[model samples]
Target: MARKPDTDKRIAVLGLGRFGGSLALELMRQRWEVIGVDANPAVVQGYADQLTHAAVANTTEETALRQLGITDLTHAVVGIGTDLEAGILTTSLLADLGVANIWAKAVSRQHARILERVGAHNVVLPEHEMGERVAHLVTGHILNFIEFEDDYALVKTRAPAEATDRTLADSELRTRYGVTVVSIKRPGENFTYATAGTTLYAGDILIVAGRTRDVEAFASLG
Candidate 1:
């Protein structure tokens, strides 16, 4: 996984709205130096004591950003949610300033595309992604679902009662369920990579990976 600079792992958050404010506070809690910037003075003051440095500045303007040492930070998040134009401008400025890791949040597909095109290293649609995850959780079929590109996912779920107490080879999951167990997580124990000899016990949790449909089918066994 990519990380911030080893010598000075400081991250700058542009925009002090709900998303950016929460991100900055979380970063601070994780012991990371954070510079919180916002065009609104009131918002900057709100987090002044909690953040390493909270300043009221217009990130959309290159001059204001340069004065705020925006380029000095190697990591940044452009969560200017309400203003697409400002979000795009901030992303562009951050890229031009050579910020290595730029994460931008967008409200819509079109907004996300624009941010990406303007040099956002990563674009996020939080609401949409959270909603999808919630939908999966509500099904109560899988313990957890991690979506990847397309409809593929990596899930952790309990072993079905009928399929317990048997070696992985005996379960015939690949043949019968069309899914593979990547690992097994026993209660209060670290996960162990799945092998043909591994046996599933009642309540054993399986870390599985495959298409979403295949994962669901596999989970249905439990």
Candidate 2:
């Protein structure tokens, strides 16, 4: 008898390139059963021992995917690089196979749009996102930053001089700076949720959220 698929934690990653390979390994570290698929026999052989299952198969073909039991998996990632046609076809095939969750990588805005139209549940432009993130980190005091689709951003940074030595309510951060401190971490202490009455001190770290420009301005304050 065939073992039933664990839809909750099992995933199929099609393409063993850098981004896909890294994501697969990390998912494995988190205890997910990962099936790595690629057309290159050498690539499959390289990851055969590391992944839960690795196979060399042309992912763009529906028959090939079915032969590999990809239809049984609930989640799939189309990580084909550069070959836009192949990536699109593979994503479409996964969608047709009734995979519940589909993630695909896009190299450009047009590619992202096409992937979405072709039934990709999620599309990521890794290089563009990484470039934006790196630009923020290098240009500001932010230790980390994540920007959303709506131009809002969440960032981690040290408490600015104006924000420290005062309660959040008294500081009037939202009124003055247009940003909200979501949480704070004092030296040697774990992070705690921030409240209006929460007081900030120098050297404390803060998790803040606001419009991207507002957050950047607030972090720039000395």
Candidate 3:
């Protein structure tokens, strides 16, 4: 959905890493006034002509960031990935400056835990998570899934061996596995529902829900 252009919403992105650069460009494409900052001279120069204002500055320096008026921005992202210390320092400074929303990137598990403890609103480890997803796909029998919270997950897994050739009511999946069959997708345009009196086929994909471990175990059933 296209957003109605709002010229007044100020957004700032610190660190011109690949992720930050893409985010700034996207915000600009949506007609938002964006301020992109980075300490790298080459990165600032490369995007100088692309953004509303691009500058080379130390984002972790509270004084420098305050002078940029980043506090006035509605949202900001601290996309420092290479240096864990810099990422944490920049995030801490942004929180101290009272930025309304702050999103940060983490390179490791410990790094993510620290960012959360330091008052960052959101933490992301995109590369690490993507690597896991890709590995799952490559190994096969791992249906598509997404983690919504630490414990719960929404997954689309292949029908378990016990569920094959069984109708929804006969499967007893909800009572046994504690997973709700949200939907079922068959070949072509066919789809079965939780209420559908349909028998499962060999290649059918079942969109299920439960704890993460439950989902993993079900996916392992060839």
Candidate 4:
């Protein structure tokens, strides 16, 4: 009997390399049913016990994907590394299969463009993004950074000296610096939402949101 697809919180990950394997494990940790697929039998075997289902198949072939019931899966991630042809073929096949959400890994700008053109709903350049994030962390006081479209970013960093000992309204961070401290965490206590009347203390960790340049300038303040 053909297994009925469980759309809710179920995902298929193709290519069980470092990126795909890590993603599949994390999804499992989050309580998602993950179907892991890899062309290499050894890779599939290693993850068989960890995932909901692990299979050895060439995802680039439509017949192979059909045999694994990939068409029934609403979400799929093509984590194929280095193999541009396989990645593109798999993404194209998934799109033709009518998978609603297709996320693919790209090795370069051209690869990303082609993936988008071929029908990858989302393309991630993990190495590029990680390198950019590391650059921000090492060059500034930013403890963590998440960049969004249009140069906007949310960052975690220590409260600047000017912001310490003053309420959020008094500091005029939004007006003067064009950045808003959304939340703060003191040394021992948990993070709390930042309000106009909330006073910041020295060494408090702040989660700030603003344009990239504005956030950088705010983090640079003494």
| Model 3 Cα shift for residue 113 (angstroms) | 2.2
Tens-digit per-residue lDDT, 152-198, candidate 4: 99999999887889999998999999999999999999999999999
Sort by TM-score, best first: what order?
2, 4, 1, 3
How does residue 145 of candidate 2 score in lDDT? 92
lDDT of 1 by residue, 1-222 (tens): 233352567988998898899999999999999999998898899999999999998888889888888777788899899888888999998888788889999999999888989899888898988888888778787888888889889888889987788998998888887788999989899999999889999878999988889998888777
Pairing residues by index, what is the TM-score of model 2? 0.95
Write one digit per residue (lDDT tens) for candidate 3, span 75-122.
788888998888899988777777777789888889999997875788
Q: Pick the candidate with the highest TM-score.
A: 2
**What does the lDDT come to for candidate 2?**
0.91
| Least well predicted 10-residue stretch by lDDT in candidate 3 | 1-10
How does each model score on TM-score? Answer: 0.90, 0.95, 0.81, 0.94
Off by over 4 Å in 1: 1-8, 188-190
142: Cα error in model 1, Å: 1.7
Candidate 4 clashing pairs? none
lDDT, candidate 2, 88-160, per-residue tens: 9999888888888899999999999999999898999999999999998997698999999789999999999
Q: TM-score of model 1 relative to the true fold?
A: 0.90
Instruction: Please give the CA lDDT of all the candidate structures.
Output: 0.87, 0.91, 0.81, 0.92
Please give the lDDT score at residue 4 for candidate 2.
38
Which of the two candidates, 1 or 2, achieves a greater TM-score against the reference? 2
